[model samples]
Target: MHIQLVRHATLRVAYKGRTLLVDPMLSLAGELPATVNTPNQRPNPGVELPMPAEEVLGGVDAILITHTHTDHLDEAAVKQLPKHLPIFCQPPDREKLQNHGFEQVIVVESEYVWEGIQLYRTGGRHGTGEIGEKMGPVSGFVLQAEGEPTLYLAGDTIWCEEVEHALKSHRPDVIVPFAGAAHFLVGDPITMTKEDIVQLAQAAPGSQVFVAHMEVWNHCLLSRDELREHLTNNHLSERVQVPQDGEKIEYKR
Candidate 1:
């Protein structure tokens, strides 16, 4: 199995016989407006896309969207993706995607098998307090295929009971965690923080964790350097990966 960690939460996963692009935000840097109050609130995606949109979208058999957040599915992606391609997303975003002129949009409520892979829905908590409730429904996914490693893609979420349940139940071999610690001016962090990363590392021993949703947006508080340093200091650096845009990592089962 191979996975490419594209910018932010966007990535490509290659399993037994399918190539699935997950949460593609293809807009060029500075194209989108600021999402929150920040001194560097010039625009979203503070950095440019590492590769061309076509290159990133190449060989994609399907698309998997955890939610309809702009960072996950931006304007450029919604406009550029082929209308005929299959889009697998959460139940709430089904009608939204359909209204966007997509021909094939499938909602994953619990577990669903598409082609040769098994996709299981895992719950998530985007934040705490009233802010979390306002974030709406988001989901994580556990993907399993014959002769491939089990992968758990943890969408935009902080450390919570839902996450603990996912680790205890699925016990995936690979976990793609959204660890950006993103937040707004008046709310708590909506994503994982350093302590959360440490807790996750401790909870899921031997499971490879890949950090996502960092270093691009203004709202995200954590940086890749700080995350790596903390992990290294804790002697847990090798267990997690901070992959760059377009960087591909292959896992052997």
Candidate 2:
């Protein structure tokens, strides 16, 4: 199995004679607004899509969407993708994905099995408590292919009880989390903090935790180097990884 990180939460997963694109946000700089209902604004700065959405995504057998946020699912990606491609998403995003022309849209219940991959839907909180109300409910996906390692894709969420439940239930070999620590002028922190990540590693002992979603947006304040150092100091460096944009990593059993 080959997993390549393609900026933000976007990724290209190639396995079992198929390529799946997850959370593809392709747009030019200044093309869209930043945060919803906020005066804070900035340029999109564009995405480094592997190829044109129409070209590469045609070969995609499936699309796994974590959420419907613009940063994860852009208008450009929606317009260009083939209508025939099957879309797998949580209940909240099913209607939106189907409305966008995808004929086969499956709303994940407990687990959704496709080909040899078993995907489990786990609950997620957008922020701490009150802040989550503004951000909306979210979910993470735990993916496991026959003989391949299990992966837990922690969507836009903070470290909460639900996340801990997923970790204990799925026991993923790799935990891919959004670690940008995003915040607006109002709330506290919406995303996972560096301390939270360290706690995550400690909670799921022996699991390799991979961090992403940093530095791309101005609101995300955490840095990659700082996270690395924290992990190192905690004697958990080998168990955690922070990949750069376009970088690829594989897990072998």
Q: Candidate 2: lDDT of 20? A: 84
Cα deviation at 178, candidate 1, in Å, is 0.8
Cα lDDT tens digits, model 2, 9-76, are: 87777766678888877775567756753334665633355445555465678888888888888898
For lDDT, the strongest prediction is 1
Candidate 2 least-lDDT 10 residues: 37-46
Segments of candidate 1 deviating more than 4 angstroms: none
Give each model's whole-structure lDDT: 0.89, 0.80
lDDT of 1: 0.89
RMSD (Å) per prediction: 1.0, 2.2
Error of 1 at 195 (Å): 1.4
Name the lDDT value of residue 174 in candidate 1: 91
lDDT of 1 by residue, 76-174 (tens): 998999889999988999999999999999889899998888999999999999999999999999999889999999898899999999999999899
Residue pairs with backbone atoms closer than 3 Å in model 1 (clashes): none
